[model samples]
Target chain A: MSTIPEDLSYTKEHEWVAGLDDGRTVTVGVTAYAAEQLGDVVYVQVPEVGAAVTAGDAVGEVESTKSVSDIFAPVTGEVVEVNAAVVDDPSLVNSDPYGEGWLFRVQIGEEPEDLLTSAEYTSLTTAES
Target chain B: MSRSTPLREVHEALGATLTDFAGWLMPLRYGSESVEHNAVRTAAGLFDLSHMGEIFVTGPQAGEALDYALVGWLSALDTGRARYTMIVDGNGHVLDDLIVYRLAPEEFLVVANAGNYPMVARELTERAGSYDARVEDRSESFALVAVQGPKSAEILAKLTEADLDGLKYYAGLPATVAGFEALIARTGYTGEDGFELFVRNEDAVPLWNALSEAGAGLGLLPAGLSARDTLRLEAGMPLYGNELTEEQTPFDAGLGRVVRLDKPGDFVGRAALAERAAQPDQEDGPGADALRLVGLVARGRRVPRHGYPVTRDGVVVGEVTSGAPSQSLGKPIAMAYVSRSAVEAGGLTVDIRGSHEPVDVVDLPFYRRSK
Candidate 1:
């Protein structure tokens, strides 16, 4: 029953990307399907601001009660901002995976390729479940 | 397709998350596992344990056969009582942990883990060839439901007219529950006061419904295997595939107290266990430095899950057996087998994925109910 917002792009790894209106940066977080599969999120590790990352690189980690998963970079860029609120209370990932649970904002260095549209992501999650 | 318990439909009706456990379709959680766990801690929680195996051993030689087959002195175990014991191979490796209930002077009921019970029944049948006992697998005929927590007795008292006060821990008696016959045992694995009802398969739904109604006023929730795992982990109980297995003996798992060497008659694994006990404490040798089960508490929220390596000074010394987020302690806790040398050195860390997280060694049983 997870809703995939039409405005956001997604990764096969279950991460969702919201491109900011400025077009220079994007906010990233895990999809609601990922959060539901994880049951409860207890800890989140976000890359420090100013760290350089390439697309598809593992930049952070999400630790749930029973399991742990890595957060991959959606675009080749430098981390511009990290969400301290999500780090303080990780349950936001389960409660609001697409909103306040955003992990970090990255300044896009190269336009990402191979990102799935919302419809495709929806189909992928449906096939998986 | 996996096997379904008699209560499977009822669980589906409640919208429980079903998962495959030991080839059986069992409920993993009703809703939120943490909510069920907390309910068991603060009040009481009901569990559908029909997946467990029940084997009946009856005849005049039932007690004698059990004593020779297992590690405990079942012949001396008083009637209407139950004892926790283990079945081991000739090499002293544990096959399964069992709870044997002496229901009558010549009858005994052996309850075993669902995954290991078929093997247990086969082993019992093979071992009892010379005795006058008859082993029958009654697993299909029975459905088990347990109400566990501090308020378990209070909830159960409303359904049955049986004397709840007289039933001691581990004692079971035939009682009428919700107008159906049940063998009510005052036993549980959640480190709380509870009752396990063994009823016919046809009575499972009615019994569960009756208990649900009686427990509504009190804080009884339907719990699943996920919550049960955490509850037992906090109680420092050893799980079969985790803390125990054929690769390790009861002594290696710090459960030597359950082995009865002075119980007169010869039992399986007695010779090997005696030889093991007589060996000198040799450092780094299989005699004494095999492994010691210890508790590990995470300094942070990253849990040390099963098969995670436990390290000391960057050297892998042990592996985590069972771990979870302890609702009562508000932290992640685990049981691991640390080598003697690493344990003595003090500083320990759990390799969570690739990152080594600092951990503190603590005593087992992170949570204990106040009697």
Candidate 2:
């Protein structure tokens, strides 16, 4: 019931990091499990482009119907671009969390080698349920 | 910390996501919140409300006791009726908002919020000493099941001998429903005509099954706290934690009319309420900046959350108390307490992120029954 692509790196916070086709940037988004549990994300405050961010820093906040959660960054990078479409339409995260609803792309100077693998992320989120 | 409702196993069986709210392992939802919200709005939905605290007050002076315990007149209630009242503290601040049902001439059942059960019971019992009333906590021995929505009455009418329609809103009738001896109350949190059934703990499962079976034809689904929240929000109803709390008085929460100050005699917070009412509507009441509850509807899909600042002309004015993208309204809306000056200034704005967005100061019940 989960889709965790092996091509990406993961975080304990359930964010997925995929190296973009440009190679210099990595696309970041929350995993399907995290989005599902968040329950109808009503608001997303994503960081703007060119904002400097460190690994494990809260990049933004996502609010659901019942509670609010901080979206964490898995790699040390500068925000290259934000997905305004997803910010306008939060249900996209619920529907296509990994693909079109990708949170943002960061031009990371250093991608964390300690990032979890897809298998590890799946195991973690499954245990969380 | 220990007890689980009869629906616990059923919830887990149906793969519901469970949460420990008020020491009860209640299901927040079985699946999607959107689907759950739609289910209750479209057809019928069942709620396991056994976690609600039920206290019985009996004896000749029970009516007098409750009148003093609550900010409501209990002496005037008919046997088969219920009233929504607030249990206030010494400051007239709400301890808990509850529904008191007069079951008999001298007996009443006070239903309280799950989180404030012990405090409410203790506060009430202490005040009940002067009167001839004896208090009993029936939370563990009894179970509550609420079937709500337009289809609820149709499904239940087939099983209950009582005249459900005759029992108007906020009224109760002693009757047998689905062969279970229960008190059928035409009262609910959702803005709909429905019944809340109170039964023995042992009979909960069967009653649930019978209701489920009968509801099958009416598109009924077992709803959880998720649906409950959205449904109540659509109805513009306030939650205990969000709208009403220890710091909030019923009068400030837009429930001032529920207090009958002129009625015979003293309540727990009578002097305080009288003082509050008599004080010239202070922009900021004594010892604090002026604050009053108000609603906000964001223009777009963006939801303004709790603690987010409400601004006007680039000045921070208020903070969001509770907010959600309403399933029924199809837009993001919020409730917050703004300064009386800000509210009177006509137009207002809420600071969503860095941008200040305008908010409409309208009447409550943001969503109305269109059907």
Candidate 3:
């Protein structure tokens, strides 16, 4: 029963990409399904602003009470922005995973081709749960 | 497929997140584990400990049999009292940490960790071959429910007519709870004042419902194993797999007091334990160079997890056994086994995923409930 927004694109690693329609600067955050599975989030590490990254690169880490996970770059680009609010308070990732819990933003380097649609992401999460 | 407890359906109905633990499917959390942990620390929290193993040893020689099988002098334990003890191999390595409750003059209940009970039962049976004791693994027929916190006594008092004021810590008595038969033991793993109700499997749901209703206004939540881990960690309790292992002894974990070498008869690991007790500080002894267990509080926000290495100036000194973001301390805390030399030299850090996070080595038990 995770919220999968129709406007967003997802990766197999559970990161959701917003603004794919714009194809320039896109926002990224972990899906609600990933956050719920991690239990209570305690710490978050996001890539530094202006760092260059590629798709599937482990740029940051999300640590919950019981375990930790890697945050991968959904698309290749330079890190445009990082969420200081979520870094300061990691619980935001659990409280508002789709909104205020956005991890970072990246400028698109190439056309993203492997992203999953909302329907596809729903099936992926369903299979996982 | 993993085994399911009798409360599995009830947990599923509550929308709990189920996880496999020691081959059993049990609830990890219902809503938030932190909230459950805090509730247990402040008010109360209910736990389904049915996954734990319950073995009964009964007969005229039951006490003597346990006295030889376990590390403690159980034969000297009075009826209605419980002892925190362990079953060790001949080499003095820990098999499992157990809580033995003497229910009658000739009946004793041995509660063990879920993963080690079968072996414990088999070992106890083999050890009691010459004695007149009968060992029965009654784990499948029993369900354990624990109400833990400062207000546990008050909540339990409403459901049973038993004398709550008279029950001392680490004591148990048979009582009728909510019109069901149960062995009410004043024992808990959360390091709080609590009662563990051992009832038949069929009585679990209704008993849970009754306790929930009685504790409605007193702030009791259905807690899971995740919360239970943090609570016990803060209390400095050693987990069986994390702290006690087959390669280590109780003395190595800094819990040698539970071993009674002065007891009259010969017991398992008597010779080895006596030798260890005699020359505890000898450099050439068995565990002289081995890592000793200690508590660590992270100087940074990142939590240290199991199997992480403890380092001193980039040199690996020990390994973290258990760790978590403590709700009470508001900082990450961990229990680890560090070499004696590293402990004396000070300046300890946990290598958290390749980052040497500075840590302060405090005394065991990062948090203690104010009495």
Model 1: reference contacts kept, as a fraction: 0.53
Chain A TM-scores for all candidates read 0.97, 0.92, 0.97
The stretch of ten residues in a row with the least summed lDDT in candidate 3 chain B is: B280-289
Model 3: how far residue B284 lies from native, Å: 13
- Model 1 Cα lDDT, one tens digit per residue, A1-129: 678899999999999889755688999999999987887788899999999999899999998766789999988999999999999999999899988899999999887888999999999999987
Provide a comma-separated list of chain B TM-scores, one per candidate.
Answer: 0.98, 0.94, 0.98
DockQ of all predictions against the true structure, Cα-based: 0.64, 0.64, 0.91
What CAPRI grade goes to candidate 2? medium
- What TM-score, over all chains together, does every model reach? 0.96, 0.90, 0.98
| Clash pairs, model 2 backbone | B284-B290
How far is B224's C-alpha from truth in model 1 (Å)? 1.8
**Backbone atom clashes (below 3 Å) for every candidate:** 0, 1, 0
Instruction: Assign candidate 1 its CAPRI class.
Output: medium
Clashing pairs in 1: none
What is candidate 1's TM-score against the reference?
Answer: 0.96
Candidate 2's C-alpha runs over 4 A off are A1-3, A19-25, A45-54, A76-85, A106-108, B1-3, B280-289, B313-316, B351-357
Worst 10 residues of 1 chain B by lDDT: B280-289
